[model samples]
Structures are given as C-alpha cells and as structure tokens.
Target: MRWLFPALALMVSTAAFAGADTLFVGGFQNAALARGGSNFLWYRVDRVPPDAADPVQSCIDARDPYGILANYHRAGVRNTVRTQLRAMRDAGQQRIATGIVHLRAPAGQSVDGRYGGTLIDSTGGTLHPRIRDNLVAFLRDVYRAGFSELLFRYFPQGDNTPVWWTTFDESLFQENWQLIRSIEPILQASGLSYRTDLGVEGMPRAWFVEALGQYYIDDNRPDNPAWSEYARRIWRNYVAEFDYRRSVGFSFVSDSDPVRTRARVRHLRYIYMLADGSVRYPPLFAIDIYGGGTTDERTIFERHHHAMADLGRNEPWIVAESYFNDAVAAAGLSSAMATTGRQVRYFLQWPLDRGIDDCGVNVAPPNAYEAWLRRGF
Candidate 1:
C-alpha cells in the first residue's frame, strides 16, 4: 500500500507542542534555477535592473514576493521595490521584511551590485532625495500589501565586504534611521509590527560596548578597532531606530567563536532589558553553518550548535544560512539526506528539549531529500 507521510499533521503537532512559536524551515533557492534536484525555487524581484527580466518566471510561475523583496532589499535594487511588494501581496504573502539604505545613486544609474548597491555618492553624501522617493513608493506598496509584520535587516550578510564595512559613517547611518522614521507612519497605517536583525557585527561601538560591555569586545576583537567600531555603530544605529521598549524583536548572527556566540547572546539579553525589562519580543540568534567536507564548515556548525545550547536560556534560535558545498556533491542524495536529517533532528530534539522556541533550516533547491526535511519529514 502506498502511504503518504502526514507531514503537515506532524508539523501541526510539533507546533502545538511548541506553543505559539513556529519553526520556519525553508530554502534560499535561487531565482533563476532550482538547486539540488528539487522544485524549490527562490524568487528574486530585486537586484536586477527594472528593465531586466525575471529569470525564475521561466521555470516556476509561482513566486514568493515577500521572499524576493527581502532578498532584493539586501541586494539593493530600489527600482522594483514597489513592484515586488505588490507582487508579494498578489502572490498571497501579506507580511514582508525588507532592508533600507541611507544613500542613493544618480538617476538612470543602477545600484545593481550585491548588498543593496552603493548608497553613497562619489563625494560621500546621502542619497536622500532619490532613495526617499523610491522608499515612499515602496512603503505605499507595502501598505497596500496588507502586511502585518515588517522586519528590517540593516546589515545583510552580503555587505560583509570591506568596502561596505568601512564606508559606513555616523551621519549616513543616522540618515538611514531617519528614513525609517519617515516611513513609520505608513507602517503604522498598515498595522504592521516592525523588527530588525541588528546582527552583533553591525552594531555601533557605544551600543555594543554598552550592551556586551568592554570585556566581550576585548575577548573577540577579530578585526581592528576601526572595523569593529564600524560594525558596532551599524548595529546600534539600526537598533536605535526601533523602540525596543515596545514589543520590537531583534536578531543577531553568531561569530565563528563559541565564546563570542555566548557573549553575543548575553548582550542581546541586555538589549532585551533596555527594550522592556522582559524578553517579550523574539530574540533571533542565527549562526551560519555551511555543510561540506571542509573542516571549517563542520567546525562552524558544531561550534554554533554548542554555543547556542550553552547560551540559550529559552530564546528563539535559528540557523540563518547553511550551504552544502561541492565536496558534499560526491556524497550523493542518500548520504546527504542522512547527514542533513541527522543535523535537523539534532537541533529540533536537543534545543527544543531545552525550551528553545524556534529553529529554521536554510537550504538551496534540487535536493528532494532536503526539501522533504524542510517540509518537516
């Protein structure tokens, strides 16, 4: 007899047991193609020039506009900002989270490069006029989308490059917050709750020092003071824009060090204190775990899991991004599935057992087994 696994039933059961907290396990599929031999496809509506065609439509007609916009905002394509928001609503995804920048490029020029294209002009001035108009249009579309939640990620992973890292200035950073303030009215009108990922690496020094204290900084000063200071300021300004005292949530990505992860989690707790004396809003702590044969990837995930469990005091945790490299290609589907399944099951059982509320799996497409795992197999 052919039997279908009651995947949704299991998910419902798990979710019920886990209470209101939901575990979001999905892939970061590429817009243009499927990964790993599965139908999972990521729809990207941003980054490409407005005049350029959407490559994913050719393969999969159905699109996740919210996902696309989230990715695009990180990539910095402002032209299609409104179009993407509308697409998300039309595609049945009401809530969305997007990123913003304090600067803009000249009219007719494209900021098509990764991590939301260059925001500053050649002379190091804000791109307020150009970006403001685009943002107004974008926020209007977001309002039209009927979204109830808006999560803004100030420092995206792609922006980890030296150029983006070093270029951030206090004035420009404050301008970004100002942009958020200007758009708050639209968000309020839409009845959306706003959250942001103030990843530890992106926070400002004063805020970081205030939150994590100088001891933590001295312990994990991987980069020079300038770079670390810049990152901290980015994090601070991003968080400062939001009223954490009110039910706003904050997220942070883990550094490679286990000690640092624990320290970051502690710091986030301090941020929670500043927000409201209680950790009401979700505290999203993510760690990058790339799965491959390399020792570095394995080490990263191992340390991440240990650190999370070590530092987790009933906070929400997510494996923000994970990639299976070419080394794992030879392992085939069965091997890959077994390994991936073991990891997922481990996180679900161990952390959830310890009272952690949420866990997310990030994957690419074309892997049927991985897709099954994501669907909660």
Candidate 2:
C-alpha cells in the first residue's frame, strides 16, 4: 500500500495534490516570504532589489514550500525579471511558484506586452502575431528562470489603481477570451500543471453580459426578435470563453458604503448563477481578506455567504489573503511573533467553522501556521 498522510480536510482546486491540502499566500512582500508554505513576490520589472540579489532566495533559504512570482507586468521590464531568474538559479532554487496575470498596461504606461492599444490589441476576431511572439518570449524567459506551479489569473485587475478597480464591459470580455486563446499554447509549453482563477469587476450577471454583447456596439436592432437572437449569441460567445475551471476572486477596499458593497454582491451573484447552470461552482473561490474595514470582517464574510446561499449553492470559500493588511485584526499593530501566532490559529479555525477554507496567507507566516505543519495538519 502506498503511504498516506492523514486527511487534513483541506480543499485544493486541483487533483495534483490528491492527498494533501497545503497553505499558501496569493502574493507577499519581504516579511511573509520568511514564513512558509508558499511565498509570492511581485515581479515588478522596474524594481528589482539592487545587485541582482534575489528576494526569493532568502525565502528558499528559509525553505518555504513554494515561491510564487506574481507578475505585475510593466512595459520594457524584462531585464529585471531575467536578472532575478538567474539569481534564483544561482541560489539553486529554480521553478518559482507563480500567478500569471494577463493584463493590459493600465490606462497609462507603455503597452509593452504583446497586445497593443490595449491588453488584447485591436479587439476584434483576430490575434496579433507580434504580441503572440512577445508572449512566447516572456514565457520562455519564465521557463529559463526555473518557475513552476503557475496559476493563470484570467482578466487582470492590473496595474489597476484606486481610482478604478477593473471595468468589465462587452468588448473587453471578448478580448480577454481571445487573449486566453492566444496564450494557451505558450502556457501549455511550459511543462507544468497550472491552475486558473476567474473574475471581473462588479461580477456582472449573464443578462448583463448578454445585454452588453448585443447592444454594446449597436443597440439599434430594429426587430425585437433579432435583439433576442443577438443577445443569446452574445452570451454563448462570452460563456464559451471560459475554458478553465469554475472560480471567482474578490477583494475588499477600505471603502465601507453598504449600498456600493451590496451592489457588488449582486454582480457576483450573476457570475454564480451563470456558472451554476454550466460549470457548477469551480472548486476554488478566493477572497483577498484585508483589514481596516468600514465594516467588520464577520459582517462582511456573512454578507458574501448569504449572497452565495441565495444562489442556491455555497461551497467552501478560500481566504486567499489575510493578516498582511495594515488594518487587519490578525496583523494588529505590531509584527510580534506571538501576536500573529495567536491570530493565525484563531482565524484559520474560525473560517473552517464557517465553511471557508484557509488557503493563502499574505505577508509572512507566524509560528502558529508552522505549528500546524508540525502537528501534520
């Protein structure tokens, strides 16, 4: 008989981890890397630590389970990433864990990636070869750098600013679909099993997607039947784009307006409804749990839960980010080891009691998380 680890009841989205459910962070800074499980370093092309010294090497030194390179891609920023990959190799740590973000160059900044004028180029039924070649080149760089455990975050909230999170309209959705089509080959070529996340701002419903697709360019369809046909076709195109798993990601801002938050909930429900009829709630759903809320975490989490239950199927949700926020209850005011230790255990078990999965921790780990590993949890 094959040796088996005790069931942890941890839920991972993929079959690859058939026997184990491990902990990880969505992304992190210097402090979190020192902890354990998975570490995410923002691959900012513009800002590499001086002298090619890798920030991740130290995480490797600490022997963290995974090193995730979260790409915050900027134009003409390849060298910094390339240099760091070499640093990883020198440190004898290849194949960094990563979350692939396929986003455009925000509103301003150079459109340095393969797509031009926007994240998807001309925004029609065509693929840009230059962009495809560029994507190929970038992925090649990723491979050379010894990166693995890639999670492709579909649709970027990218280089996104506080002024705007992400605007989801009809045309952008189609373009993102095409964007996925353009890169699937390169992603496949990397020779690593990959995970994918799905999301769009406001989490628009199927009707919205249908309306936007049908009337976005032209709402002047003279006949009512023609409009229905157009809307149906549009929904098909939009839904067809999602070839990956059923998943959604949410982030909380410092804003606490109940009206706005509730509106956002409605949009997310739309996503749930559409998927329920088809993919049926892809195994993994992630939330970036931040602190310093206008509303308390408990209230917020319950509200989101109610929305899901309203949709008729509520699976275990993943707390993909936590304790890293400046105002979070877990992190508190200090980085004291003891404080975080207490906080980590309290929250991890707390969410479990509420049907949420404690998946990723942002920032660093406390002795508490380490203690779980020690106990074979």
Candidate 3:
C-alpha cells in the first residue's frame, strides 16, 4: 500500500498537470520587455495605463500578440467595458480578468433611519431579496460589459490552458462564508459565468497534519473548539469552497501562498490531492517569492522550488508576485526558474504600475529592475 501511493500520485499528477510556461511581469513597468518578445504583461484596471490611455487599450497596444491579465476592483458596473472589449477583440488580445469584488449583504436600517441591525442575522443566511437583487444587477452589469468571455478565459477540461482568475483577489474568504454562500446560488441562478480561483490564504495549519495535526485556523474561523469542531471548520472554510465553486462551474480554483516555506507548498498540494480524490480539481497552486542575493531571499526561492516539485515533473503554478534587487535580477530570474517544472504558468512581479518605489522597483522606466528583467529575457 505504501508503494502504491507513489504510483497513484504519479498517475494523478501526470494526468492533471500539463502546459507550456506562462510568465507575466507584474505590471507595465517593463512594457518594453513585453513588446520585445518576453513574457505577457499584467495590470489592474484602476491603475493608469502606460500610454495614459484606457487600461485595456494600452495593454493591447504593447503588441505582445498574446494578452494581458487584468484585475478589476469596480462593482462590475462599468459603462465603458463594452468599448474596451471591442478594442481588445480587434487586436485579438486575450485578456484574463482577476481582482476583488466586495459584495456585502445590504445592512438593515433602524426605524429612525439612523443605524442598522446585524448584517448577517441569526439564520446564518445572507440571500435576502435585496442581496439577490444586488447580485442580479452585478451579473447584468457583467453581461453588458462582455466580461463573461473575459472571466471564462480557460478551457474547463484540461491543464493545456492554465491561465488563472483569482476572482476576489485576496478578499475571498475575508467577507465571511455566509456572504459567499449567498453569492454562489445567485451566480448559479443568474447564469453569470463560471471557472475561477478562490484567492485564499496559504498560511494555515489546516495544510499540515503529521501523524498528529496542529491547530491554526484563520481569524475568520472560530478560535478554539473540540477536535471534531476544529476539523469541521477546516473542512467548511478551506475544503468546501472548492466543491461549492466546482458545483456552480469553476474547474480549477487555486490556493496561493507567499512561498515562505516548503512545508506550506507541500501541504497545500497534499490537501488538494487528498481532498480531490476524483482528480476533478487539478493540483493548481500559486506562490509569492521575492528574489535577491541575500541568504534569506535565496533560501525562499530554493525552498519554494523544492516544494513545487513534490507532486510531479510538470505541475503548472503561478509566480503571483515578487520584488528583486537589480544587482542580482538575473539571480532572481534564475531562482524563479529553480523549480522542478521548467514551465511557469504565470509570473507577475510586484508594483508593475504603482508610482511608488518598492524596493527600488517603480513605475518609471530606465530603472535597474526593469533593465535587469530585459537582460534576462
């Protein structure tokens, strides 16, 4: 039985993970690199575009012939997304949509019209009529924006199209499961769309279970409970979201970590494998590893690479974000390339569009960090 585990794991991985590398520079900081035949570019919709034009249009203008991954923070009520999609279609740019959407249940008002009642009531439910209406309006907005095509960017069946869309950015579980539970049925009834990543926290003891497991639930979960209750909360919070999303339409919902330790990565893969006994959920993962020459930074990269390889020869994952010293940008690139799988499904470095300087990497060009990336490509 012990030996059979390896064979079964190999079979699962071989069937689950397969695709060419898809690297993305965090933003348009090195737009020229994207233009000069390097990796694809990523950007947030609210951020100003390189040409100071529309965000979607500026990305298309890069002439990458591939596409850009976009983050949307607005409430899906955009008046101009239709025009933007037209421009994108004309250029044949395949845009992948991500980013957060804050859909809270409508607050109840007092008779005096001053304050409110409990947002989530005693029922442990959130799908009020108003909440349902809000979801409907949002879906209608999405339909008008032509975002259904954008959100459904990946092929539902296989790993050949490993593009990711972490739907709620880093705020997925933060909004309470009751809210998400309400949203899911609306998503189903509205027939808005399907297939997205759940943007969950990576650092949790639920990922690990030696012969004896440790207890570390996120702040969103109950603090201390009996072992059975602890297990139930973990299943509800971490494990059940995948099945719920899959039930609606999501094919490969991903879990991302900061990539600080190999254990986190290994355990996440373990959780994905064990929970997904049927292999319905591909072992999709994401990591964040800032690169540099320092021992701490280099160790971060090394440990992540080792952990990423635990599953199979070519497990597709994303280098979601990073920061690197210009002096050792090549070393950083090399560190990013240190994983068992030669392919990088997606690579989006940090602060690609922000004006502020992040560890010397900024929006302005002619910076050492941008130069370093160009040299590597």
Every model's TM-score? 0.45, 0.46, 0.43
Tens digits of per-residue lDDT for model 1, 110-138: 34321122222211323335444544555
| Superposition TM-score, candidate 3 onto the true structure | 0.43
How good is model 2 by TM-score? 0.46
Q: Is candidate 2 or candidate 3 better by lDDT?
A: 2
Please tell me which predicted candidate would have the highest TM-score against the true structure: 2
Candidate 2, residues 241-310, lDDT tens digits: the string is 6443423332222223444444444444333334235533445444433333355554445555554456
Full-model lDDT for every candidate: 0.34, 0.35, 0.32
Off by over 4 Å in 3: 1-77, 81-95, 99-175, 185-194, 205-259, 269-282, 289-302, 311-314, 322-335, 338-340, 347-377
Q: Which of the numbered candidates is closest to the native, going by highest lDDT?
A: 2
Candidate 3 accuracy as lDDT: 0.32
RMSD of each: 14.0, 14.5, 14.5
**Stretches of model 2 off by over 4 angstroms after superposition:** 1-13, 18-42, 45-79, 82-134, 137-148, 154-173, 200-202, 205-269, 272-279, 293-299, 309-312, 318-377
